[model samples]
Target: MSIVTDNPFLRLSGAVQAEGIDLGVAAHYGNPMIEQRHLLAGTAIVDLSHRGVLSVSGPDRLIWLNSVATQRLDRLEPGESAETLLLDGTGRIEHDIRVLDDGTTTWLLVEAGELPGLHAWLDSMRFMLRVEVADRTAEFATIGSMAADPAAESASVRLAAAAPNGLPLVWHDPWAVVTRGGWQYAAPEGHPAADWRWSEVLVPREELVVLVARVESADSGVAGVLALEALRIAAWRPRRATEVDQKTIPHELDWLRSAVHLDKGCYRGQETVAKVHNLGHPPRRLVMLHLDGSDTVLPLHGDEVFAEKTRPEAEAGWRVVGAVTSAALHHELGPIALAVIKRAVPVSVPLEVHSHGEVVAASQVVVVPPGAGAAADVPRLPRLGVRGL
Candidate 1:
């Protein structure tokens, strides 16, 4: 709904800036399908200057962050990449922070329009702690790529991550595998995400001018947010920016696979995270939809999803089941989307999505299984011992 319109990359020929939530950055360099192929081959880069960057420094940064977030950061070693979520009092996701502690300052990368609130919240929580928070978004920006490991490999050494007397501030994506104490609620490690070698490098804002020159050169290539979103959907990745709402919890989207640590100590909403995970099931589940490509419809955020009722009570009309949160047309997969549906909705049922006054048929591939929660093993009471006789 917001726009960051004056990006330098917009000066490049054929560069089309994206609108809506990803408003400010280039959506594609003329052809999105070609961009998708370039991204998949690890030869393209996406300018993510639209993201927000922050820094948390001082002696108590790690423990302070650990106490307020869902991930364990107390022992986060330098050069280690982790993801954490800040939850509300009831354990619903409030903020998602991509964390990288370089043994000096903890660098946080958040979605566009999230920095001000997160910065204020962290500042208010300081309460005499030996930590300080600063918004560095103006000084730094993000560049994302499908480099198996950006810091280790030389995808584009010219855009080396900013290192102010420490390790490069590149966040190697932990979503490719579960972090310490995290759980996997989706398909296991060998799933499509295994092939998702993504990383984000924090570079100096001033360096973007030079980076763009290289991008426009004959040796480099650039892709758009459309390409990135399509690949992310194919990988079954849950993006906190658009996938979540007021009712969102970690289990509903299988975010426990990386952003949550079940064994971690108390934090806001930890109880609900534990309860639904260890005793009861989450009320909803996430699924990937294969949209019928015969139509020209592309669903957007909050597009209604319905179950086609073929029963005798068909007069009741199609039952609303969920809504599409993100959609993209992959170069290979055609039209696809990530939708959140009620857990009680049978996975085998036929589905459809309504957008722009057109209804398109859909089929779901489960991400978070209906029986995902209730993970703890508890022994049954021994038949109550016949009323204690």
Candidate 2:
């Protein structure tokens, strides 16, 4: 009963559905609605229906979107999408979106369940442009692909996958242009060049309930958030709000290459990004922490990380060099976490994740480029949690 795209090959075989994973903590995850690991292992799809989709149209669509977003939209043609970002005046991330170009209309696909916030942000910034923005989450079902074939070739409602050349290629006109990840294409909705020109994903909003039922019956279940987290962490990808907190800036989290266009003109937060890259030093560096013990309870999103031998009293563990922003129990890697650590800490030193009192053993995994710690004073530390706080 699960819904598959109109590919006859996929339809002939039994319907394969996504399964959801159980994220250890409640607040850190969205819904236990999918099993994300399966998506990474092979070809799997997730019902991203919970995500939000928006449309921007009007004569000023290209000009306005180009001016406001972090990335350039003027270079894209019909049937293309790019991972773009929206930053506050300080260059800290405000929102991240996927920009889809359907030849005529521009689409913005945002995180599911985050439409209201994204919409509000867009509205607040709206002034005098021919652009018109509308929430289209209710109008279409959004699905994610981890297929081996390029995402564009898959039988999707529309294609927003990257081309071999890394271009944000689009395949159809989007009522809501959908970027796979990032923010960038928040344009005015009215230009003839940004108008809908191809066939769109045409599911009516009223049938969502039935579609859910069909989707459930076909695939065993959607991949849960845990699997997705594992996949994302492995990919070294950064997320908004969750990964970039009040303490985070674009350069520290690697957003400059993926989301920010350094060569582009000024926007909100441009100065911060520029200064940090050129002059100021980022306080902390983003790293992947691999937990050692199977019994260890994975740290929560904001749980403190400490150097065990540094201190031994309450609030005395080196004052916590960093904290876990997101974590997952990797089936293959045991417990794992994404942490933001101070650049002064040793890269290979054993560390402990302090979940109140419970200590989890962790080792630093080199994911991003070398930082101040690459040549720091790192002793061959003992097992994680060798010293208590």
Candidate 3:
């Protein structure tokens, strides 16, 4: 069922319903390029109410959350925000959460589809802890924007100004920096997300209508999911639904840059995480694809990506190596996408994406490099019986 079935945003003319989360809003409000510019200029309001929110309260909230999540939150200050992940027993990412603490309650922002399961898991893990979990989705909605606006000095000020009801709790994205205890796989200086000044604010669900009206009345730009997705892909951001597969680990998506705390104490999949970072490479790597826009057939999610095989023993001229996770037509960059492929796929090779009996040419821009792990450079111990030279 779509979460926006009764959302007031549907009243906007030209609104289109997307599959997931029922993102029923004007995809562009008539000019997508303008909307993109608004986002970059910090003048856009993005409707992200499709996401879910959960509240954790009580004395043990912080400790209990820090124990289970990948990010360190034991010392999280009130109104401060962080990103974390919930991995399965094998270190595969199961849930990605944006966390915010407001002193009394901890707010967890998660994908709508994963909400029920994540809430249940947190409930089950609270065996003896004083933490109390409650679903805040019905009462709260999320609004996203870039933090680059010079007028608003802080997230609190911006959110408060936008919400007439009162100050809404905000969660600023931690992707811009390498948090303490986290490791960054991407180059520090040139990462696409380095300049991404993004933040999401939680507002009373009933206030969404008022917020939208204010934005439109002020001539402040408004963008939908399509615009946000394009900017995200262009910034090389990996979202859970697009970048993660069943076998995915944080290392595979370069999630260590912000989400994983390498030195954190034991969690569900910490051993596998440590082993992979110290001694092994992720089996797959994430890559950005600049799709050829001349053909007009953009590949969709799950479209098979193939590479031209050079060896004579190859059965076909091409071999299927990966699949497109997200594809978007950027207002400035045209058609672009993000894909996860076998780590062995040569970065030099021009890739092909097969969708609907059409082949779309794609060129790779490495995101997670082929050699993605063994970053710690742990020294190998000498043989037990051998003498040191």
**What lDDT is reached at residue 216 by model 1?**
76
The TM-score obtained by model 2 is: 0.70
TM-score of every model?
A: 0.95, 0.70, 0.91
Per-residue lDDT of candidate 1, residues 1-389 (tens digit)? 12334578878889898988788898988999999998888788899999988899999999999999999999999989899999999989999999999999999999977888888889899999999898888888899988665545465433568997578998988888877798888867457888888889998888778778887785667889989999999998888888999999999998998899989889999999999999999998999999998988899899999996657774756899899999999999899999999998887999999999999999999899889999899876767446754
Ranked candidates (lDDT, high to low): 1, 3, 2
lDDT, candidate 3, 1-389, per-residue tens: 12544666555555565665434444555566677778777878777778888989999999999999898988999878899999999999999999988878889998888898998999999999899998888778887888553226552225442222233487888887777888866666688887678888887787777866766566455777778888889888889977888999998888998898888788999988999998899999889999888789878889999999967765558989999999888888899999999999998987999987989999998888888788776789998999988
Query: Considering TM-score, which of the candidate structures 1 and 2 is the better prediction for this target?
Result: 1
- Candidate 3 wrongly placed segments (more than 4 Å): 1-4, 21-26, 149-158, 161-168, 313-316, 380-389
TM-score between model 1 and native = 0.95
- Give candidate 2 misplaced runs (Cα > 4 Å): 1-37, 112-114, 149-221, 308-318, 369-389
**Candidate 1, which ten residues in sequence have the lowest lDDT sum?**
150-159
Q: Model 1: how far is 208 from its true place, Å?
A: 0.7
Say which candidate scores most in TM-score.
1
- Across residues 1-389, which tens digit of lDDT does each residue of candidate 2 receive? 12223321123223343332211211112332234444553334444444567778777777777777777776767766465677777676777777876656777776653567778777776688788888876555454444433234444222243222333433232222323333221122431123222222323344434444544465323343456666566544676746777656766665554566667766777777667665555677778888867565768888988875443455444347888988876656667788888866766567888784687778887544444212223466679868855
lDDT, candidate 1, residue 272? 98
Question: Candidate 1: global Cα-lDDT?
Answer: 0.88
